[model samples]
Target: MKKNVFFFLLLVSYMAVAQDTTVKKLQAESGRVIQKDPKDTLPKIWRIGGLYNLNLAQGSLRNWAAGGDEFSLTITSILSLFAFYQKDRHSWDNTLDFNFGFLRTTSLGSRKNDDRFDIVSKYGYAISSKWNLSGLFNFRTQFFKGYTYSTNVKTFASAFLSPANILISPGFDYRPNSDLSIFISPVTARWVIVKNDSISAKGFYGVDPGEHSKFELGAFLTANYLKDINKVLTYKGRLDIFSNYRHNPQNVDLFFSNIFSVKLSNVLSASWNLDFIYDDDTRLFGDNGTSPALQVKSLVGVGLLVKFGQGRER
Candidate 1:
């Protein structure tokens, strides 16, 4: 009876030791996995990223009753950069967006159909979890010469920096989540610049005749939102409005943009973008002549896309 009792006690002790050993082994394995995770080494204060896309299209028509170009080709390229920072109670975000495209038709030859360059920066000091004091700056211009190819004649419309815009606003920023932001400013400053001597002399783009720049004080509001609807679909939108107190306060300026992206693969995607603008001072040429009107542009493309850097943290 004494020998049986001692053996039973020894077996119980052995099982306890084995269980402790297994627990220790599991903890060590978990520690190794945690150490190997890349997120543990990634920087939290600064995030940077870039996106580039290239698209091409071609069409050839044989003899058809409906008249069309014999052969046509279009090429477009878009590049964007992002730099964002967050630490303590301070935050800063900056972005640069550029796009250019050209089309070649058998009748019209080669001509530019799209050109845009925009830069935006915002800095904020937190006043609460969802509100902050913010300062915003934006600049917009075009890359190359643009023309109106009406009546089979190419008439020069605009050139680089001929109608650049600069805007600065100090206001309150509201951010309810990582994907949405809103800003409003009661006093905003804006400048319309025409660097081209000929364009400035013609009083193009809201600038006074013979003047290179025009200044205005206004009220401004801006909103931006971005979201991924699913693993393969994404959307982004922005809206901006300004009312000039010194000029036509009733004729407010408007700008709106939207983008949708569908991922087809790791490196290929399809995208659609639309932009609308209405500024009382800016003129658009129509069948009659140049007049202030709402302007709209849209693009659809499927192409290769390259992305880099860490994504936004929630």
Candidate 2:
């Protein structure tokens, strides 16, 4: 079944490319093709930009009538970046993002609050004005160890590369404009890698006992959106859905993320992030330990926003 699906995808891709070539040929023969002006400056082919935010909170009480921690400190930092290349019918897009945070208090000692790292890359060849033959690559993991405390006992939960997820997909991309893209693929491959022996031995994240990786074949769909609501407000989001044919296809996985930001000044901004995820194979969060549950995360922060490198303006 996998071989047949791949063969069909290849056939479709070939036909689309051939049809595009024919259309271009006919247009040129009929003198309908618009000619490029030699005097016009070349469009910039590379775009790079990113944003960074840091948050800090601290409190110290020498002697207070009210009860409070003697000393407390909290810090969080985030980095989001993107780079893209575009010329003629070919385009490439890439992004890398990181989020890490921790908090310390005299009463509770120290605890991690957030941790994440992810990267994505996609390349496309235009098949029409709004459609492209595209391939996408994405990888996500964490940077620091995660733990849960029960009855003052620290328990290991996750770590760097302990639950790394990697995806490779080839399919059709529908991009109507600079701010929206919808990709669909019938043949998507994903590998969940666990480098930690302790995590792997327990079959965490769907890996078999004592195994380092698990493979999945699926149909995947992802939609990305970005919009500037006005001079001060902006919104961006992404939604990813996958159906695993090798396992229970009906029990699909879903992940969604959204960011809303408002500019306060030239260097200051406020932003909020919200994420939701669900995977049938992730049974640890369920009450029965055999089912799946929705997981949600959210954070709000106010900090600096920096922009560099030119991107074709949206």
Model 1, C-alpha of 260: deviation from truth (Å): 0.9
Assess every candidate by TM-score. 0.83, 0.82
RMSD of each: 10.0, 19.7
Model 1 lDDT tens row, 1-314: 99999999999999999999999999998888434675676558888987888888999999867989999998888888899998989999998989898999998889887898999999999999999999999999998988866676566668888888899999999999989999999999999888988777767578888999999999999999999999999888889999999999999999998888899999999998888999888765667546788888898999988888778422
lDDT string for model 2 (189-264, tens) is 9998989999888775888989999999999999999999999999989899999999999989998988888999
Backbone clashes counted, model 2 = 0
Residues forming the 10-long window of minimal summed lDDT in candidate 2: 283-292
- Clashing residue pairs in candidate 1, if any? none
Cα displacement (Å) at residue 54, model 2: 1.6
User: lDDT score of model 2?
Assistant: 0.86
C-alpha RMSD (angstroms) for model 2: 19.7
Please tell me which predicted candidate would have the highest lDDT against the true structure: 1
